[model samples]
Each structure stands twice: as C-alpha cells, then as structure tokens.
Target: MGHDKLLVLTDQVAVSLATIWEAIKVVRKEGFEKLDPLIITQASSDCLLFEEPSSTDDIICVCKSFEFPGDKLLANIYGVLKPGGTILVYLASEPPKGQTMQSPLERKLLLSGFLDVQTSESSQSLAIVGKKPSWNIGSSFSIKKSTPVLPKVNFDDDMDLIDEDSLLTEEDLKKPQLPLGDCEVDRTRKACKNCTCGRAEEEEKVLKLGLTVDQLDNPQSACGNCGLGDAFRCSTCPYKGLPTFKLGEKVTLTGSFLAADI
Candidate 1:
C-alpha cells in the first residue's frame, strides 16, 4: 500500500520528532498504511516558504515548541496545504491559570480561514484540528445570474379609477394662514432670548421700570392711553390692571400687585 504524505513542523526538533514517531506507530498499529513524514524545522521567517502552494496533504504542528506567533505559522501552513487537507496542532502544556487553550486555538484557526475547526482537550494534551476549504485560494468562478418574475396586474375597463384631487375639498387644498411676524411666541407666550419682534426692548424697559422706584411711582405713558385701563394699555404697560385715572394722577400699586405669583 502507498504511504500517506505527512508534514511534521516543529521548533523543538528532538521532543517533537519523538512525539510524532510515537503517533506514527499508533497509526500503523491501527491497520493504517505507514506515513511518509517530511520533517521541517520552523524558520525565523514569517512564512514557511514552501516551493509549491497547495502541495501538502496533511500537516502536524507541535504548538508547545513554537517560539513565534501562532497566527503567522498557521497562515503559512494553510497555504502549503492542498484543498480539503487537514492540520493537527498538538499542545502539550495547558494555558495560563484560569484560561483554556481551546478558545484561543479555535479563534486563530478560523481567522486564518480554515474550515471545520475543532479542539479536543485530553488529560495530558490539547489537540486542535482544522481543514482547508475544498476550493483552492485565489481561484474564481462566475456566479449564475437569476431573473426576477414580477406579479402581473390586471385592469378592469368597467371599474373607474378614483381621482386623488376629487377627494380634497377647497379648504383642504388652500394653503394654511401662518401668523405674519418675524418673531413667533412659544406656547408659554414668552419670546426667544434674542427677540427680533421688539419684545426684548419691551422687556428691557420693564426691567428698568422695576429697578427705578421713581418710574414705578410716577409712570410716564408712551402712547398717552395708559389711563384707559388694560383694554387700551400697550403690551408692555406697567399699570395694566390699574383703574382709569387722570393722566397726571400718581398710580399707587397695591400689595397684591407687588406680590409675585410663585
């Protein structure tokens, strides 16, 4: 029977070779053909630098023997493997305290684009198995184009199509009448901070009137209609609730008027 091709990769030559030899013996005893193992010592280079891509049938890596990053090593191994080829990584030692090796190994294998990645943990060692996809890397094939079939619409000549314009009345069609002013008052009847509609100036005058006791006692009417009560009083008139009096009469505000609403 022809021998199955296998590639044994390791950084620690003596220990890894011994381990591989023991595994080979086990396989032979299980009624399998002898493995033609090609041993390769891992180099310092980022890649394994195999002469031909997709040439190796199977690869075995002694993970505990690696000195460099496992990702770089796995990426190189993936390129060397033929389509549907499998890789077996043997980790002889457990990971750091409280951490498992299975998750990290599975992640690295998946990131390297290996398919059907699996991890098994034994009492002595952990083994990670991953397979290259059936399709070769860099190979491309055209996707089959599909045409969509749209649902057919049937129009009845007897049925009249409703006019959208006929549904709207003259009131609904007319443009809404918006209040004509540069400054719009909010729901609270208060103007914005930077009022453009002269409310800021009125507020400033009201503030000034409140500050000056003389102005509050002897009020001056700007429109000459302040004595006509609130109906004729200007928007910012201080004596809004005051009774109609002579223009020269001094308006004395009551305790109720002086007290705030809060």
Candidate 2:
C-alpha cells in the first residue's frame, strides 16, 4: 500500500483478477484510489523498466494457478525491486501434483534475502509478503581468518599448600564470632561463620546454582518482567514450544490456517 505503482505478475491476468476480486474491493474500500497497477504474465515485459535495476516499489505475484517456474519469476522480481521494496506472493494453499515447494512461501522468501517475511491465508489461498533490505545482505558481516590468541597461564607448585605454622593463634581464635541467622537481621559487613550470611556467600551460592546476574533474584522459568511461571506466560512473549524455522522445510499449520489449508 506504500507503493505509488504496483506490478502484478500472474500466469493468467483474467483468472487472477477473478480470484483476488474481493481483495481488490477491500483495497478500494480502504481509500486507496490511485492504484494504476501494471499486470504482466511474461518475463519479456521486464523491458518496460528500461534496464533500471530497482525502479519499482512493490511487486505482487499471484502464482496460485501459475504454470511457470515460480523461483525464476521470484528471482526476476527481486532484481527489479528497489531497496526496501515489497514483494507479495500469492500461492495455492495446497501444492499442485508433483510439486516440491510444499513448504510455506514465507521461508523461501526469508532465505532469498528478504526481511520480515510474513504469511496469511484466506479461505482459498495463501499470501506471503516480504521486504528487500536497505543494506547489502552481507555488508555488516565479515570473517577474519586468523589464529585465536589464548591467555598465557602460569602455575605455582605451592598453590594448594596449607601452612600449619601460619594457622590462627589461640588469641586470634578467641575473637568473638559474629552472629548470623535471619537475613533481615545481623547486617554485618563480613561473613558470619554460623549462618554464612555475607555478600561473598550469597555470590558463591548463586554461582554454584548456575544463576546469571539477572537471575540472582528471578529465574528463567519465571517471567523477568511480571515474575510469572509456566502456569501463566507473559502476554508479550512469543515462546510457544515450536521448532525454529529452516528454509524450505515442510510445515503444516494448525487451528484456523489448518482449516483453510484443508
């Protein structure tokens, strides 16, 4: 919708127009009146761009009933798109017989250098949309081929030695031991031998329990913000126990999308 002109690619313009009629009506209803969309069904029509690499702002390709190689068309569209341009693809909810692209179109777009790829399904089709990155794909990344530097270690033979001659004297041992028990009471600067109440003991206990600095007061199983556990996940978190995405991996959506796919 940010585009001044949108290019629509499809195998049959007439057929696609019929399929997306309702969507077109919705777009019109939303007060977008100046959409002079150019429809194309052939790669030869790319000559219309006059050799400009990134002239268009948005390209919407409808491949739900397309018979051509979708990958080739997508690559072509990617080449013609401007930086931060949008690419929206309409794919069939179900793959045609013998097609290997059964995975969600969103995965393919993301791996192809598009950002923020999203997918939504209608009663009859699936729509995938993505944006071209403003920066070069690998511009911010670099790998240095150099050997790692390790710290020089020095070992002392007497490191574990316990000197009995240097042990505490009777007079030194007779010094009164500080009282400790409740954390609320006895706020001593040094450790109490009895209850082990001190900053050092607390830090040691935390480290022994494998807790992070932030987790010193709150654990991971519980929300850091609201302090809620598994019984109630924070409304803001997207932590559903599903597997992470791998490009072109086959997946099946459940709930409402599943019904639409069926």
Candidate 3:
C-alpha cells in the first residue's frame, strides 16, 4: 500500500539489479517504475547526501535498534527537501537523566536562517499552529514612548529608537519614567491619557504625608487594561488597584503593590 517503485536499500532487503533481465524480474516482482523507488537506508547523513532522488520518489529514514545523531539526521532531511517543502522532524524533548545540557537546539533554531521551526509544547499544542517569525524591515511599528498620544507613561523617551540588529536588554524591557517635564508642568495641563490604578495609592500616601495630589485628582481619563473597573492604577502594574490614604479628604500613596495600605 505504498508507491509505484520500490528502492529498498536495507541490507535485509537483498537486491539484485545486475542484468537487465534480473532487474526487470525484481521490478515486476515489486511494483512500479524502477526509477521512482522508495529509498530505505540507514546511512549517515553525509552518506545520504551523495544519493540521488527521483521526482516522484520518497526517502524514508528508518531506525532499528539505532541511536541516530540528531544533527546528522537533520542535515540529511534538509539536503533532500524540495525548495519550500517541509520535513517532519521527529524528536523526544525529554532526555535521559544526568543530562543538564538542555539542547540549545530550540534557541538555535529560533536564531537559525530557517523559517517555521514548528514546536509542539512551544506553540502548536496551544492552538492553530504553524506560524513563523517574519522580517518586518519596512512593516509593523509600535510607537510607545515616541508619541505623546500613547497613554503609557513612566518611561524615558531618551532611547525610543530601536536598532534593528540590537537585542532587547533588561533595561530596555523595564518600565521607565517619562522624561522630566515631558508633559507640560503647567497647572492648566489636562490629562492626555488617564493614569489609572495604583497611581491612586501614590496619591493616598502623598495625602497621608501631606503632599500635593494634583496628578491623581485629574478628572479626564483613559481605559487602562484593568477591565475598566472603578480604579486608578499604577502606570506600571495596572491590574492591581492603587493604594490611597483618605486622611480627611486628602488622598496620598503610601506604597506600591497589588494590595497595599490606603
């Protein structure tokens, strides 16, 4: 229940393609075209490369009581893959004990020249799979700190331009402060965006210590990610409600966290 031709090269499958007479006998005994036979071999990847392929042929790499080199097998499969064709790489993510060496294979694949290195526990198992990272040379854009229109704050706009080749540093990913006076310091300054959540805590503490609560008291607002519930949040962690101290109508922020004092 396979293909037209049968090119069984396993030592177990003794072949006799000697004379045209014997060849024809073997061919008739098998199935279809001798040219389009299924390749069955255990040769190392290096050796596999030297072999040729027929357009309508299939190469099957089998394992029988053998531990094949993963990299070698990968090379062999790739060498024969038709341009844009896929190769099903079978591997067990779980390794034997005492092997602290996590195969850098996954990370390496991410950084590799190839596209669509599908992983199960990585993505496919999660949902509709087979997505690849695309080059966005002149494509997508995110103007977080670059534009004042963006609501996010507590960021230093100093390093807004991201170098295409540079990797994200720890600091780059960290939440930063809006430049000093990046927003107008004028009392007439209105909220371009709502500073929601834990910001209230800051206001509460400031009130407790008798500090000004101008920023948090502003009425204009924006819908932060926190389900749009009745709360002002820390620009950093918006899900947690901001702490507020209501000391005789003066609100101040005392601490930072999901659940801190009022």
Predicted structure with the largest TM-score when compared to the true one: 1
Residue 152 CA displacement from its true place in model 3, Å: 28
lDDT of 1: 0.68
lDDT of 3: 0.38
- lDDT string for model 3 (1-262, tens) is 2533323322223332342223233224444333444544454433455443322122322222123324554454444443343332222233344642223444433343335655433311110011122332245777677645767667777858778648877788889776553234333333235544345445545455543545344332233323343355446543346444332343345445436467
Q: Which structure among the candidates has the greatest lDDT?
A: 1
Clashes (backbone N, CA, C under 3 Å), per candidate, total 0, 0, 30
lDDT of 3 at 134: 35
Which sequence of candidate numbers ranks them by lDDT, best first? Answer: 1, 2, 3
Per-residue lDDT of model 1, residues 1-262, tens digit only: 2455677766654565567765443324453345668876644425454646888777777656433336777888888888998887776676667766677677878999898888767676777788899997688999999989999999999989999999999999889976654344232244467777765565466465443322333555677577788999998997877888766566677788779899
Off by over 4 Å in 1: 1-3, 16-31, 41-51, 65-69, 156-160, 170-262
lDDT for position 82 in model 3: 38
lDDT of 2 by residue, 1-262 (tens): 5456567666544544564543344224463455667776643322233325777777776665534325555666677788888887765456666863435466667766788787666656666678898864346866889999999998898789789867978887686866565443543333345544455566566565555444444322234322233345565544343344321233345576436554
| Clashing residue pairs found in predicted model 1 | none
Q: In candidate 3, what residue range of length 10 has the lowest lDDT sum?
A: 123-132
